[model samples]
Target chain A: MNVFVLFKKEAKEQVKTYRLLIVAAVFLLFGLSTPLLFKFLPEILEMSGEGIPIEIPAFTPSDALKSYVNSLGQIGVLVAVLVAMGAIAQERERGTIIMTLSKPVGFGEFAVAKLAALVVTFLIGVALGALACFYYTTVLLGSVDVQAFLAINLLIALYFVVCLSITLMYSAFFKSQLAAGALALVTLLVMGIVSSIPPLAPYMPSALMGWGQSLAVEGGGSAWPALIISGAIIVAAVLAAWQVLSRKEL
Target chain B: MTEAIVCKGLSKRYGRLLALDNLDLHVEEKTIFGFLGPNGAGKTSALRILAGLSRATSGKAWVAGEEARLNSSVLQRRLGYLPEDPAFYNWMSANEYLTFVGELFKLPSAELAARRAELLALVDLAGAASRRIGGYSRGMKQRLGIAQALMNRPAVLLLDEPCSALDPIGRLEVLETLVKLKEQKTTVFMSSHILADVERVCDVVAVIDKGKLIVQAGVEELRQRFAHPVFELEFDQPADSAIPLLQKVPGVTRVVTENRAGGVPVLRVHVTDTAKARHGLLHAVETSNLALRRYEIVLPSLEEVFVELVANHKEQSR
Candidate 1:
């Protein structure tokens, strides 16, 4: 229970610093800027018409909105990973974990605190970006069902949480924060690649990406299995991380 | 005094290398106990076990009358430990660091603040409490380490080489603070290879070498038990005559001269016991009537005994 205090303290210390701000800024820029920038890309491509009778899809507000959402999906995952990259490794390297361990706090309490803090940070960044995307889409693409929009936002936020959980797993495994940060990013990419190969995409967390993408076409049902599995995956990853960390020597 | 700290056959192995070998230790309550060993002698490993930071490979230890292996996280709230080279969160100020440690112990807000202020002041860090620990000197860091250790008024405090990183002045201050801790009835188990620092504040000294405890006794008893009695004497005769007769004394082991002034005889005597040697020296002096100018008992310093014990162990190990 007191681990909440420790978690809150970590979260507070983290937010007061520039990490949270920078992450939000990067995602915010991606959320707000990518769609608008890509609106001109189709035009630019159509003018380039120097080859093979090239045709370009007409730029639409949905194209702009998907660009924004996809940017959030990709870079936001990176931001989440980087934000939590060293939660455990930082404490290990600084010997701060010794201080925490020397107290009544258990490894579960410590790891959970870090995991939850990252989840909350990811939620904050993605939620804000989703809000920006939602407003911009309303103005450009005309009103979609509010429910579909919120569902997509919810799915994006869930994807961000998946990244946070993976980052926590990496953070728990490495001695260097950089190792955790790098591994989390790589793991995300690997998950994406694994899902892209036929057949396996149905079960992978990265399938959530494809699921999020198809939300406009097939609605939320396309992602129900992915969402359910992502939930299962997050819990399994956290448990696996806990097992690895519980046995790890300080 | 009750035993505040006890370890029974505490064995730890780092794979093939045995860090601690069947180590048994008992430290009396309210006494400053020095846990001494050279580098890689498993001093840190032992202290870490006691602090509950690391688990033992084989055996168990107890701190403040409770078992100390695996459950040390529970013990963490009750005891304080400083690693050999304790690294702070370089990002936090000294006050911030101590407060963070205090919070980990679950000290309530007001109590935590007052305790942090008091401990910071005790280590002479009140003036620089706001300075980032990374910016502090080694001495300042060591002092802050002590303040943090004393934060909870832990019944059993374990310090791992508290003075090892400090300047001479910083060393003196930390040793003095440790002395104060002893007076406050906090049983302290401070580990170090520096005999002088141990001798300064610890009355009970436990010496571990090569992962085995060579001796664990009071500083006074250590000097009395590990070494033979020694005496320096000056007589008004040729030094050569005293050497033969001095060895002839029942308890005396060797006779070597330390000073001979203007042809006067001066000799240093190694005896098994000072009381018996005094009797023999008086008897030798009375029989020979050699005018005695200087006759004094010289006991071995802890440093000499430590070196001798470790060197002997090294020789025997090979």
Candidate 2:
């Protein structure tokens, strides 16, 4: 119940600080433009091809959705880190944490509330982006499988959650937003690199992005291990953040 | 009276510099207790430990019968704390912030609303309660801080430099609110370097220097115990010649010369024996041929007592 109250305040803060609007706007921009860019790829290539004859294949709905997933996977991760890097760091820096923590609120509740709010923000943004991408893909390219597209978006959202939670953990570790953001980015980059290795790909949270891409292009085996591991990572990150804030001097 | 707050050998160390050095304190219930110290004197550190905002490196503390430690919800619920520089979500209005704080304590909707209104009115911020805190001045923010700290009607209130950012009128308003809190049987432990405010509102004051407790006593008791009587003498002419004569007077421990505005020479004589010093000072002035315009014995201010105490403590430690 205390967590709910704190979550409400955190949600309100996200909206008032324009974090919700900014994240939604960035996602929608990518969502709408991904399909459009693909539909016009041949023309764009020919225009820049300097009159050289270019062989181009017709675009498919799968192609458009896959491109959208990739765009969101890369750009969305950056947005997630940037948005969450200041979650706890700025609060500590501004000394607002002292006032809030001096109440009947637990440190775990505080940390969990922050992650929950950010998750909701990213979920809304991802849903909007997915709807935009689906609508445009149906009109410009061929009709796509709605179930597959939804599943793909769910996977992408989970991947972004992993990013947000990791960044939020670092936010609790450092008082400087720049340091937190840099370390979180580096950590994600390392995870991305590890996901490319065949042996480790199934266990890495970054593999969820691969699962989404494959789901868009073709029905394939599920990355259940990656899915389970992603959930664990998020839980661990939130707990780590709570522990850091509990021990912090602010 | 029962003790609302107690610290047994509470010590905090930052690197090699000990901010609080085996400090012990006891604050009685329903009183405005002032924690007095100079800058970097571990006053904030002690208050933070009591507030459960920071942990002490060693020793133990209890507030309202609950052990004080970082992130103890039970302890937090029993007390309200306002940091030296209280910060809030700047994007939020004072009304929204207060509501949020009330919700943290799970105050009922109707009761929370009433308490919010009452506290805002108490701090004189009801007129601008809906305004964003970012737009507030420092004094306004300080007032809002006090309002939020009272949202739960906590049994004990810990405030660090509560009036440091307030204007003279704002300080008076806050001090008055503190006095009223005392009337309501709430113990308020406030740490401040502003001796005048503490002297005005505090029933008991504990002075600490360099992380060590120097003295603790009631206001009048502190004045009487640590303060010496001072004699102020105003003369029409220069009293430079009288300094030597005054120093030779019996019971005169120290003689300080001052030039009042427009260059009127005055002498302040700090004495151990007020009766003997008074008579000898007058005789010394007569012998020096200085025309004495005024002679009065003035009780020492808290400022004087504080300086003298800290100086003596430092001297003794050396």
Candidate 3:
């Protein structure tokens, strides 16, 4: 009950701060632009041409879908990090956590409640963004495969969950909001760079985003191992955050 | 009387700094217990340990017969704490924040609303209940902090410097609120360096210095134990001659003269026995050329007792 109450407060905070609106607007813009950019690229280039004939690759609906997934995997992850980087760090810095945790709520419950709130908001924002992309992909280009589109979006959502959890983990561990954000972005970038290597490709979380892009572009790859690894890491991050925060002097 | 809160050798060390050093404290139920100390005197460290926000390095504490620790949900439910600098979500109004806190305590909806209204009125914040906390003054925030702490009606309320950041009016308002809580038999353990504020509201006070307990006694007992008996005499004429005459009388320990607002000299007689000094002073004034305007016996205030106790403790430690 305490966890649910805390979750509600955090969700309300997100709404009050207009984080939900900012994320939704950013993702919706990505959704609208991804398809429109590809459809008009040849003509846009023609307008800037120097009279030399340029051969443009025949663009397909899959290209637009692939672009949408790529944008979410890259820019969408950044947006998630931006929204979640201050979830705990700001409260701790401001000494607000001292009052709230002085009640009957456990640190584990507090950490989990915050995580759940951000995840729920992230999921909703991503779903709405995915809907916008799907609508544009079908109307501007040819018809998209519904199953393949859902699968790619789901995989991308999992990738986003990993990003959000890492942001939360660093936010709990660090006292400075800017330091938490910098460290979370650095850690995610290192993970992405290291996971793309041939040896670690199958077991790394960063591969999930690539696999999501592949699925969207009709280049198939197994997402199960990355899914399992990312899921375990998410659990580990939440648990570690709870442990560190519970032992904190505040 | 029952012990609402107890700490046994409660010690907290932050790396090399000893925040609390083997401190033991007992707060009886239904009493306003004042934890008094200067800054860095470990008053806050002890209260935080009892509130279960921070752990003691080597000791244990209990609140309401249960061990005090963050993991004990049952124990936390019976304890309410207002931090030295109480902070809240600025985005929330006073009403919304208290409601959120009540929900965390899992209060029934109807009961929560009733208690919220009662506490808002108690803190004199009902009129501003709908305003965001960001717009509140420091005193307003302190009052709302108290209201939130009382929402659960816990067995005990731990306040750290509850009136430290308030103006005189704000301080008086908060003290009055705590005085009202005494009727409900709420055990309040509040810490402050403001001796006058403690003297006004707390029945019992424990003075701590250098992370150790110096003295623990009732306000009256503290005055009787550590304070000296004093008498003040205002003379229409210069009392320089009367000092020698007064000091000659037995039981009159020391005499000092000062000039009042109108340049009139007043004699302050430190006495060992008030009854003996009363007659001796009156007779001396009549016999001498000094014309006495008024003679009054002054009991020691808590401020004097606190200073004497802290100074004695410092000297003993040295």
Which candidate wins on DockQ?
Answer: 2
Per lDDT, the best of the predicted structures is 2
Q: What residue runs in model 3 are displaced by over 4 Å at the alpha carbon?
A: B231-295
TM-score against truth, every candidate: 0.85, 0.96, 0.91
Looking at model 2, residue A36 earns an lDDT score of: 94
- Per-model DockQ: 0.38, 0.85, 0.68
**Of candidates 3 and 2, the better by DockQ:** 2
Clashing pairs in 3: none
Judge candidate 1 against the unseen true structure and give its global Cα lDDT, from 0 to 1. 0.78
Q: For residues B125-179, what per-residue lDDT tens digits would candidate 3 score against the true structure?
A: 9999999999999999999989989988989999999998899998998998888
Identify the runs in model 1 with alpha carbons over 4 angstroms from their true place: A40-58, A140-145, A217-221, B71-73, B228-297
Ranking by DockQ: 2, 3, 1
In candidate 2, the residue pairs with backbone N, CA or C atoms under 3 Å apart (3 or more residues apart, or in different chains) clash, namely: none
Candidate 2 per-residue lDDT, tens place, B1-318, comes to 799999999999988999999999999999999998889999999988988888999999999999998878899899989999999999999999999999899899999999999999999999999999999999999999999999989999999999999989999999999999999999999998788999899999999999999999998898899889999999888888889999999998898887779789778899999988888988998999988899999988888899899999989999
Q: Best to worst by lDDT, what's the order?
A: 2, 3, 1
Relative to the true structure, how large is the alpha-carbon lDDT of every model?
Answer: 0.78, 0.92, 0.87
